[model samples]
Target: MTSAQKPLHSAFGPQTTAQEALAGRDLRGKVAIVTGGHGGIGLETTRVLSNAGATVIVGARDINKAQDKLSTMKNVEVIHLDLADPKSIDQFAADILKSNRALDILINNAGVANPPVIKDARGFDTHFATNHLGHFQLTARLWEALIKSGNSRVITLSSISHMLGPIDLSDLNFTKRPYDKDISYGESKTACSLFAVELDKRGKEHGIRAFAVNPGAILTGLTRHLTDEELAAWGVRRGENSEFISPEGFKSAEQGAATSIWCAVSPLLEGKGGVYCENCDIAAIVPADSKLMTGVREWAIDQTAAEMLWTVSEDLLHIGSIPGLSK
Candidate 1:
């Protein structure tokens, strides 16, 4: 279904923390898979979910680091997954399915930002491959498990940057146009938002719902590739005597994860799907001139674009229609 892009007047806002979002909820017995759950907001997402008694499986590129960081957490496990590699994506999905666990929540949270222009072994743009295509393939492979859960949610982490660029379907890999880091990142995020739109449409009848979230700008390792000058340009800073800091209005890692956890378990969103959310509420759709950093862009939630992306993704991944989903 298409997104109306209307606000839900949620009780939570930008200041809400992950712990706060899950305060009254109990996830005891639920099974969740969080991609890139070893660091930043992903780690916080893992912590809070597991704290709430869910069995969280973290998909990490560095299993040792994930294991080390999660050592103190009970009911959490880490598995190897490199979203940039298709083989790795497939294997991770296979292994998870082999566990005979019904997947209750799938958070597509791991992503790269503004890396040097490069392509995967399959020649797809690195940002697109890791941020969107990988999750698409993973979700497709895990369709059965998600269906088995009876009521499941797939949360795809998008960004406000999705407003900055349009998807260049003709040359999605940047084979012809000069590569622009921000634009490439924007396109990938837009793809993520649209993926949620189409995924919800196709899976809703089977009791699966998907949402795309714009976790407000948080100081995370996702910004590791940005240089000092770039950070300065964005008004962020780091002190020789202190820790890295973000500009005013940026959320803390826990705060950044708030919306993700909200979308994953909020009863308010029970019957809704395909909308873009932020600050723990459904975001409004705004025009290009409204705001540079807030609200959902029309293209990001367009039904037509979502459908096109689903077809293109299927062709790119060489998959036919989803098992129980019709074309």
Candidate 2:
């Protein structure tokens, strides 16, 4: 049930703001969960969704900070969720399930930048654990609520960096090969896209469509790990006054959040799922040799690889069978 990896020639572009994406839509009664939705583009995402009448739940590790940051935002509440900790993820899912709410949208958005070779409790790479596995487990745990909606959308934020490489199923945590931050980051994002591939295959039958989003690079906490020199390489120069000299393709936080919500609500995507999207359109599959910054790589959408990753992820989380999805 994978959708075609081709653009819709959409009216939206890289510059579309989150606010503008939801301009004419009314989302009253829709319940959405946005992990790490209290900061940067996630904040803007939460803001836009809340403004449009959705009851938004933000899952954050720092309860107080998240609560404080989202204090003024209406139709929103912060819940404790630390993606790195399996216990925390389980509890977060349990809390939501208690409400018996039908989750209309689930944005697997909380992620950490590549900061060396950090690992979770199970010694899995943080990038793989937090960015992919955590979300995978969370989504699986919330399967009941999602299917209850009968038309839920799960949007995972992948990145164009996925073009750098695909996941190495043999050694995902750098246990065998040397650790490279760029490769680690790229592979994790690739996993994000692949999650959509597999999830859509399994869940679309139950009306749970999945999408992978590339929210064009925007300055946020995700870049805090990089040094000034590293930032400069990306064309992000800060003056003595701390003003920005941004790169040509650099996006504002608002603009970066546009495609995410668009994937959540756009009528154009009603029957579509399982495609990697960029700039508010379904991205084309580029040649593996492509040096281009846009479009998805064939490996990222490889259905076989996606199914394997899903199995590996279930084993990693020790959450064996996905009731209706498992063979």
Candidate 3:
């Protein structure tokens, strides 16, 4: 079916480039903070925002890489931020707060793929810690700046992988369940979507809107964990010799970054919040029995689930409240 005929919300497709999405849009005075801005869709996001005249801060774990990549861009600042490290998050927040600049946009895009079971220095699962909790803490720490910047937007990068699993709050670390890292990654992405829902529900009164984006299959560092054979088995084609895929599947990194740019600056989404988006548009709700590979899942967008996960996440991080974030 054509996108207009589809029941679920339609977007520009996985092949739409960032420039195409932001065509004719102007965001000269805006400031955007993007994690993983040195590579993948994150890098494209940074480039697009900067080109549109926004002051883009490139958050990277690797200082040298961030500096090198952002050096050529005007009004771009590269800051060291390792989402997996709480201390690093705190430092990044503190530095930004000291500078006293309001944060206009935050794209929680840094993530890890399926890796062997490993924990951070604090013994949290690598996927949950990096993909969800780390961004959670970072957002919380930057809550003040986000609030201070009127009309601020926070976008979390979720994925279709969320449909593969649900959050396992009972044993969030996978200590009781089998140590399947892929499942853990899926669960973490689910948490990312839910978190955005809760954030928007609570923070909208302050002009801070929250959203989650599913950047359809893009060849980026996030997929580095999968080998060539695994990628082929997963129905992903890389080389020129690959089989022809339908229009519904896969995209380049620039195309993957499109929705984020749209959400960040589009007048079309004014006053909207708490929705999962893909392909430069708000995602349509998924039907319970539908087999469509697009749109947000019910469980991932559940209100109760989102609130429950928020509480659980705070408990695990040992923080009673998100720094400057309050209902």
Candidate 4:
């Protein structure tokens, strides 16, 4: 099942919001778990899914905050989940499994972008740990519920930044290299894209499919690390007003969540998996010198790299022996 990184001429485009993507769909009786669902585009994603009648579980690092944001929503539940902490992830997975609910959609939407150089307790780069490794462990632990659903989709939020960094498997933890925030962030996103590729291939037998999404340049909490000056440099803001502004290609939170929602419920993607999507459709494969940031890079979707990443992730997490996931 190789990736066919080509557009499907989807009805939705750069301007479609999450609500628009699910406008006519009824998700009654479905169960979805959206990580970081209390903030930014994740919040919009939660609203749209719940509005469509799906029972949505909002996984958050801040339980109180999540409750405050989501308590009013019908069919929405908040659970404690800190992606950087292994114990938190394990407990969250245990609680979900104990509920005996089949998981229909798993959106690995939580992530940190361009934060200060830091490492997890395990010494893994913080961005990599939270963005890629955490979801890796969670998906593996939730494998049973996902398989039970008969058909399930996992959407991982990658970014166009994935085009800016190289995956250095030998020093994924940045132990021997000088850490650059942008490069580290890009590497983590690349891991995210690759994770979808390999996971889809491995899980397809059990009716699980996965996709990597470039949600576009949305002004969200994910940019918390960036200063006003940095935002201006990125064209997300301008002048001395210091008020946040959306640049030319920037998307609102609702629009940012569109591709994830589309990947989750759109019939157009049935039997399609392991592809990188943007603007609600599979993206074209661009050349190295293409000068465009819209499509996925070859390294991000490379099967060999995906396989290697899966193996490395298993070894790092010490879950290599997990049934059906070991290399």
Name the lDDT value of residue 85 in candidate 4: 88
Report lDDT (CA) for all predictions.
0.91, 0.91, 0.83, 0.90
Model 1: what TM-score? 0.97
> Which residue pairs show collisions in model 2?
none
Model 1, position 94, has a per-residue lDDT of: 95
Per-candidate TM vs. native? 0.97, 0.97, 0.91, 0.96
lDDT: the better of candidates 3 and 4: 4
Q: Where does candidate 3 have its weakest 10-residue lDDT segment?
A: 1-10
Candidate 4's residue-wise lDDT over 83-114, tens digit each?
A: 99888999999999999999999999999987
Candidate 4 accuracy as lDDT: 0.90
Superposed model 2: Cα runs more than 4 Å off: 1-3, 241-244
Candidate 1's error at 108, in angstroms?
A: 0.3
